[model samples]
Target: METDGGERSISGSSYKRQDEKFKSVRRVFRIMDLVSERGEDLTAKQLAREIGTNLSSCYYLLGLLVDEGYIERVSQGGGYRIGPALPSLHQGKPRSDFDARIEPAVKELAHRTQRHAYAAVLWDGEVVVTQVKSPPRSPPVGVVKGFHGASHALALGKVLLASQGAEFVDGYIDDYGLEAFTPRTIVRPAELHAQLNKVRMVGVGADFEEFARNLCCVAAPIYSASGKVEGAIGLSTTTRRIRDEGQRMTSTVQRAAAEASTLLSDEPDIKDGKNRKSG
Candidate 1:
């Protein structure tokens, strides 16, 4: 009887440890899922809150995941995103079919404008350039695929941020403070808010040497079928060129963005309060 009781106690203890180990594994995967879904937007504290764990435990898990290349820190921010290894775990192409379909429009824009054309999307809390098309022999405009940050100073980024409404913009400002890239950059939140209102009304956004001196850009929002802003398309060129042809450039960008929106009419609706009411 004594031997049987001892065996039962040992078995119960082992089972409890195994259950705890399974819970830990589950938490790790949950972290991965959140990082993948949010794209470089979740801080350690946010992840801890979402996963119902202590901050120390969350940091430990995040460290292990970073070491394993399942998630990585953002280049310019305090958040984590899905890492290279996560994609290699699956045997599928990295770029989506939608991205492939959108390239032709960007190419056409570049050809028409004879400048650098690009498309960007608001991936959770980051503005990521998804495609770039440049005219043959055109010089680099500093925008590239996977380019992100400095939304406060970029035309495409402005279009996306304006579409998300004032509340979302406030949260964005809170998360990533507006860093002035140039003298023309809108450093004041109130001023930026006013400019975004104009963007919402005019259906276009512009950067006049805000991101870089002697460079200018114009962009228009691309809407999904449900009327949510999903992305933006824009062109970048010298400031003098834009000054000489701002109206024409704006029109061309708006037309191309509208066409892309039609092509993406069936896209899934954005989640997490996209296009929430303005303040």
Candidate 2:
């Protein structure tokens, strides 16, 4: 009887963990919908008060949503709002048009940097590659269009993740415990925080053979006209290539990203491939 009771207790603990995860996800979605309906910024305390939950719990949920790009800090309003991941111009026809508009720019970036260039966005707590431009002979390793994975492990992912802020990053780490893809992968919370801080200061994110054994990458953020982080653009190459010319490659990608962002703001109507304007 004692053995059976012990086994049941362990099973119950496993079930409780699964239940908590489910509840957390459900709460996050509820908060997202509430933010969308409000269509404005709401402080964590305000949200918590409205939802009848404690402030700490609200912060945890908001942090997770923000990290996943479902919510974003309001620049001028001083609170949280539904992020770009929610329904927006980018969620509809604009995305296809956006991709077409940025395709050539990415190709040019790849050509200039002599690497594989890519553009990615945060989607449902993961990084999704939306565009890619490979060098003539193809760079050694790179993410392709529609590729999705843990955002903490990729250059493109780290850039987007860094834009969300440290509190959100903490929530992300808590929700999706870092999985070491390679020996170099950053698995420690404090180390990843420091790395993200550097990215925040420099406007660049780097993965030095962290995701894969011999692949390296650098990335920069693409900003919306409102100064919000829209997504990221990256270049992937051999670790040796990055080591030999990482500084040059970083400068090239940053310039290209700036140009692309300018075009995104200056050309809102040039959607289809036919109306695409040069950046």
Candidate 3:
């Protein structure tokens, strides 16, 4: 009887450890899922609150994930978002629905504008180009692969930022300090707010040598079916050339974005907090 009881005690101890391991695994996945679904980053404290974990444990886990490249720290950049490694895990999956619906419109915009067109999404407080189309005669645009940090410096970034509302913009300003990319860049908070207001009013954002010398672009917001801004579509060209075709460029880009907006599942406008007409 003593031998049997001893064996049972050991087995119970082993089972308890296994159960704790399972719970830890579950907690990690829960963190990942919440961050991914939010379409933005979360601070360690915010994540802890959401996940119902103590701050110490949450911070430890978040740090581990960051070291492993499963989550990224956005201290000056923004917040903690899914790490670059996460995308590779989905490499074998088929193209996303956003790609399918937005690509055709992007191509049409490029053809119509006779310039470069691209689709960008606001991920972790940065503008990330997700798709691109360029006129056959145009040279390759080297800006597609990276995220744009200076939201106030680029047309697409500005439009995406403007659609997010005041509170979001404030957090963004805090995450990515506004630094002048060029003399034309809006670095002051009040100045940037005014420009963002114009972007909202016009339904288009403009950049003229703000991000870089000799470069200009115009962007329009793409709304999800629920009416929230999902991303933006932009057309790019040399500043001198775009100056001559400014009105036409804005028209084509806005039209393309309006078409793309229909493809999303939601269309909730973050501005008035209602679903307004895409027009």
Candidate 4:
């Protein structure tokens, strides 16, 4: 009734069941990998290409995933990003792995520079603070919340503007009307453009009390794996400390900023608040 290998016994009805389960698991992993790779959004057709499968097969797999809540169908933001089931992707893994990586790098910068280390990602034209870690003994200046910035003047803001391109920034300034938070803020459109040019070349930017007098900040842009400037990260310190400690941070911040780019590359699709929605 069975072959000499004994597989004939298990490979019959039992082996059929085992093989089906194995295939199912392999497919699930394939889907997860694809979603992680393309963070913005994906059509079934797009997913098919990435998975190197037929469109119909991709659709069926995606449907099963969507039904299982492994990925949510976002109605807004972008489309089809990693879903709420992401926590379970690794069997309820700790939430701090990515944050853990950014923390030490930032804390080191903050410790060395004596400033508040912060990270910002541009979302829908507004910058959102994804990470913020303060150094010991550093005084606060109330600059944490999202859009707690002026695109024209803040170092991070200018870094973003410069990365977006001149005309795009110019148009934004003309429309929004620079708030001119302090005497140091640059209100002139041409001047801001010129400053952006320098920011582009220098690969760093300084706030110089533009947002708040006696509060100065310096920042560098963070890029994603695709070389897109996904966000900006830097430090903010008081004028006194900046004069003394800020200069020391310039190189550290620059290196950290560059590393931030690589960090993002390693983590392509799962940044906080950078989700896409599916209809």
Query: Which candidate gets the maximum TM-score versus the true structure?
Result: 1
In terms of lDDT, the best-performing candidate is 1
RMSD of each: 8.2, 17.5, 9.6, 12.6
- Would you list the C-alpha lDDT of every candidate in the order shown? 0.79, 0.74, 0.74, 0.67
User: Whole-model lDDT, candidate 1?
Assistant: 0.79
Deviation of model 3 at 30, angstroms: 22
Per-residue lDDT tens digits of candidate 4, residues 50-128? 6677888777888888777566554544445555344424322322344444656677776766568887654334344
Error of 1 at 92 (Å): 12
lDDT of 2 by residue, 1-279 (tens): 247556534477788999888877777777877776662557777788776678999888888877866676765576765554443244566765566666677889988866788998765455767777777886335654555566888988899888888877877777678999999999999999999999999999989888887788889998656676777888887876777889987898898789778767754543221111122
Alpha carbon deviation, residue 189, candidate 1 (Å): 0.6
TM-score of 1: 0.65
Off by over 4 Å in 1: 1-95, 266-279
TM-score against native, each model: 0.65, 0.62, 0.62, 0.58
Candidate 1: residue 271 Cα off by (Å): 5.8
lDDT of 1 by residue, 100-209 (tens): 65678888999987888998876655566778888898666756565667887999989989987898789888877899999999999999999999999999999999
Candidate 3 has its poorest 10 consecutive residues by lDDT at 270-279
Candidate 3, residue 183: the lDDT equals 92
